[model samples]
Target: MNRRMMMLALLAWACTAAPAVSAASPPVDDAATAQALAQAETRGREMFEHDLAAERATDALLKKRMRGDSRVRGWITEPKDNRYEVSMIGEGAVVLYRATTDARGILAGATEALAVPAAPTAYQAGAAAARTLAMQSRIDACAKRYNSVVLPAPGATTDAWTVYLLPATTDPAAVPLGGSYRFDIAEGRITSQRAFTRSCIQLKRAPRNAAMIVTHMLDPTPTEVHVFWSLWARSPLYVTTGEDVIWKIEDGRIHRVQD
Candidate 1:
């Protein structure tokens, strides 16, 4: 065919192809999406709680070890039955201390062990990898000044990570406002990121332990960082998103409630 004729033929094909391509993609179901988000937030909270319990149970011990033991790099947590196991990971993939702790911070009979099993489990490996990447990220700079959390991604059995960086504050007169970030990572690469605020905002805390409301415009839905913040504060955060969706993050979980 001539060049002009070929161009017209290709144009005709393109006109016909558009509808089929559109038809191939299924429309998003909002209900399902909301449910999925709830599930993800729940899983994220679960993982965070596991690490938190371990930290509470072993922080003093870990503090001494971290200060003196050069081999201690970081820690990993795994769910074991009704309890959670904490392992102080060391150089060359060894465990300096391993023990299980319950929700109340009661540790197992084995308070300390070189947790060298036959091999590292996939769950522990995922937690470890997330911790490693988090330690290596640019976020590391802010960690010493903020409350940073690294958790395994929900629905990912392996090789996925979720990170939360929150501004830490001790001033009783000021409430550290949103200057948080949540990152979704896969196989050592960040796939997506959401920042809670362009920069940190600190509001005066007149009445302490009072309920706080946050205008979250960075995303359509509130993220796990919201949950972590609420958990850290031991207070509920009423997060209003751009879509007019109000999510309540309380007691380490997020739920949508009527505003």
Candidate 2:
């Protein structure tokens, strides 16, 4: 992964699988874990919001310069000491623009003139950075085939990736089931990939603030992208892992269900 990817581990903490929950036994949330989850949730929400702001900043320039152009590939959010660096990539496989943002997702110390284009950022400075862009572009291209929302996240270690192709649809009534995929990339190649299910599974949207129960038969724990998805959905998720261990995902954090 590059500096721009997984800039800061959400909450600067490692997410792990929580112990299983037993309905018959009353559950109590762990004090430390609960605090970590809450802190991570706040960070994730802020990251999501800031990333959107970066996109808006880049889009404004795109509209003024290359109107109706799809050469814009995608972007990566890099967190700084107390700010974020958002680089907008173009079809040339280079950063065409960059934006800096503060904590509130507001444009801070960010300005660029559309009158003169910035010199293309050399993709060769760092092999990992270049490869990251290449891999992201590859996924971006394939995303067209699956028609799912593709999110690329940094893996536990650098030079590793976990990309989620989610069935993220806006329609609240009919959830499109299927076509969701999770890909693992490392050592400059796709190491392994898995589909969440053989086909799509549609479930009704829970009311605001209500948690939806979804059975996830893949990992023993919930993935980071799941937290991001939960944040976007504006609702919480009660995910039943393969081991029947239940966890709660909300506000971009996960914790063992306290029943």
Candidate 3:
């Protein structure tokens, strides 16, 4: 079935199955309340499953059009404004998709992520300083040269930016993929910083050519910044040995949970 039809069917089911919430109403039995909650949870899961399938399908189409030889390695979806930001990883590109869906049983426009034409003057200064610090602290002798992309973070309440660094060298010995750093600027100083590196994670595995990609920035709680990513074996097959991870960021430190 088409996406629209699937969405419509799911919406109809949700509307029909939802239990009515009343003000001055009757009390429910324990079994009935539990059953209602389970049904509601089931409905929510189905909707999420449908949306995920649709998003993956869209990613595949975009990937084919942009680079036929590459595949989407991983993606993380975040809700932003009234839309969604889907950060996708391919062989050599970090593509971002801006999506508006999951409303009224319809999926609306999907397009390339829009970026500021230029960082505001003040932000440029701050980001430059922060970048220099990031390079000094994180990058080591293994990197020959690197490029960076700065984008406004969706949910950070402060003046926060996420920078992705890409290696520009032809040397195979260098880190295949580079780093992702979160920088928060305040009063011309980098108030907070956090980083993730494939080299650090791969050292544990030892002697294998490996790479890490930060696929998604997870929603935050009061005290943490969470993200999801993948680790791959840089072999002929591009084997994904480490399927997934959830990294918790707090106080300039990162802790990993493997899944």
Candidate 4:
């Protein structure tokens, strides 16, 4: 109630409050925080490139074949330096392939090389089934390939993950197949995968040509990539040579390929 008592009470409050306020205050080194962010970005880019190189090597090795009927082609695009496009050609024709990469380049995934069927022999019906099975096998192979690349990375950040998803082939004769993949970074592993089929059909009228296209779009932080495919055309009256393939990519390695 006295003046001295009031001053003492106020002093006690100020001392207690000061420590609490200081403890609650955030750090004030703006420059240091900015430097840390820059370092993370730089490190992310370097890791992305390293991963990309390894992916390219894996693709090149897989492209080599025993019968010489299959071929693989690929290229990388700019800015982030982690995006890529890849394709597989079979029997001088485009079969099936995928294109993908990430900001950190630690994850690169691709589809399996779809095999082109040899001309139907005297056993036409049986040969057609065999060829269809072969194409399906290739799709399965691609799924496995993607799985192998992505499953190795774990704790991968958004910038560290890469994905490649192949929609079911619209061509019934090609065995109607589709699948998808996702990769991790921290552990350098694959996070998930999926595959499916719709129906079965004959390939008597199926075309013999196949081709793939991959585009890498990287800039302004997040990167983008695109994939396209061309397949032989077939019809009742007359057979067309091939159909144009079109698709798009976003944020590093997200792809939208046509079915």
- Candidate maximizing lDDT: 1
State in Å the error of residue 112, model 4: 25
Q: Rate the local accuracy (lDDT) of all candidates.
A: 0.59, 0.51, 0.36, 0.30
Candidate 2 ranges beyond 4 A from true positions: 1-55, 58-66, 109-182, 196-198, 202-205, 242-244
Task: Note the residue pairs that clash in candidate 1.
Answer: none
lDDT of 2: 0.51
Range of the 10 consecutive residues with the lowest summed lDDT in candidate 4: 222-231
Q: At residue 112, what lDDT does model 4 achieve?
A: 43
lDDT of 4 by residue, 23-142 (tens): 111233487644433443343333344335435534554565322433432212222243543332233333344344554333355434445433322222222222222233334343
Off by over 4 Å in 3: 1-126, 136-138, 156-158, 171-175, 178-184, 198-259
Q: After superposing candidate 1, which stretches have Cα over 4 Å from the reference?
A: 1-29, 60-67, 113-126, 139-143, 146-148, 166-179, 202-209, 243-245, 252-259
Q: Count residue pairs with overlapping backbones in model 4.
A: 21
Could you estimate the TM-score for every candidate?
0.68, 0.58, 0.29, 0.20
lDDT winner between 1 and 3, please give it.
Answer: 1
For each predicted model, how many residue pairs clash, with residues at least 3 apart or on different chains? 0, 4, 0, 21
Q: State the lDDT of candidate 2 residue by residue for 67-151, as single tens digits.
A: 5546556555556788766666554446656677765556776454334334453322232343343345443222233322222
Q: How displaced is residue 212 in candidate 2, in Å?
A: 2.2
- Model 3: C-alpha RMSD to truth? 17.8
